[model samples]
Target: MNPIDRISRRINTLIQLPENKEVIFITDLRKEYRQDLKNFIFGETLAVKDGKIVIGKNLYKRWLQKIKTKGFDYDVKFI
Candidate 1:
């Protein structure tokens, strides 16, 4: 399969959380792929709920800060 299809397949495998439910948590923004988060169309805040996933502005900001500090250095498993 093509690379895009491969990535799509991998992403599809992760769409459902361990609970076997569609992931609605903002923490699900973490990705296994090392590609820039800004380029990811579906996993970012902007894509979730068409930008309605707002818990709080500070909450989102803190989330971003945590991600940056933790760094996207390892593959993320949805479990």
Candidate 2:
């Protein structure tokens, strides 16, 4: 498995978030992890519709690169 897969798997396991979920409510997250999730989503063009954050198709790829280059250091599982 690749690093990207490892990171993505960690995200899925932690959040159970799907790309087609439409929106991810900020309220659904623990306050401490909100910033980390925000940072991760900031990698791509972010959209908020009806008070939910949108997940773009390229988010995982961008986040993967960020992780590989040490751009994103937050441990999703720990956050």
Candidate 3:
């Protein structure tokens, strides 16, 4: 799958955890690159508590910025 699709899938899986549960995970968004080398990079974990979602990395900030620039409002939170 594409990078965006992979990321989306990962996010979806992460959000499926119970409210008090912590998700310790890893991912590889890259299918293949540079002489067929698989770039299986580590991804951040996430947790949900008290109706709020917390992300361990600022990567999702870019998506938030895009939404803001487009004058759209979304309910997304990342720690």
Error of 2 at 57 (Å): 1.9
lDDT of 2 by residue, 1-79 (tens): 7788875665564345444454555555555456665777765677776777655545644544565577445645532
Question: Whose lDDT is higher: candidate 1's or candidate 2's?
Answer: 2
- Candidate 3 worst ten-residue window by lDDT: 31-40
* Candidate of highest lDDT: 2
User: For all candidates, what are the clash counts?
Assistant: 0, 0, 1
lDDT of 3 by residue, 1-79 (tens): 6777875664554344323344321222121211111111124345655554454334334433444465224233221
Model 2: worst 10 consecutive residues (lDDT sum):
13-22
TM-score of each: 0.27, 0.40, 0.25
Q: Predicted candidate 1: what Cα RMSD to the true structure?
A: 11.3
lDDT, model 1, position 21: 38
Superposed model 3: Cα runs more than 4 Å off: 19-79
Q: Write the per-residue lDDT of candidate 1 for residues 31-73, one digit (tens) a residue.
A: 4442433332235344346553423344444444555577444
Candidate 2 clash figure, as a count: 0
Model 2 accuracy (lDDT, Cα): 0.56
Ranking by lDDT: 2, 1, 3
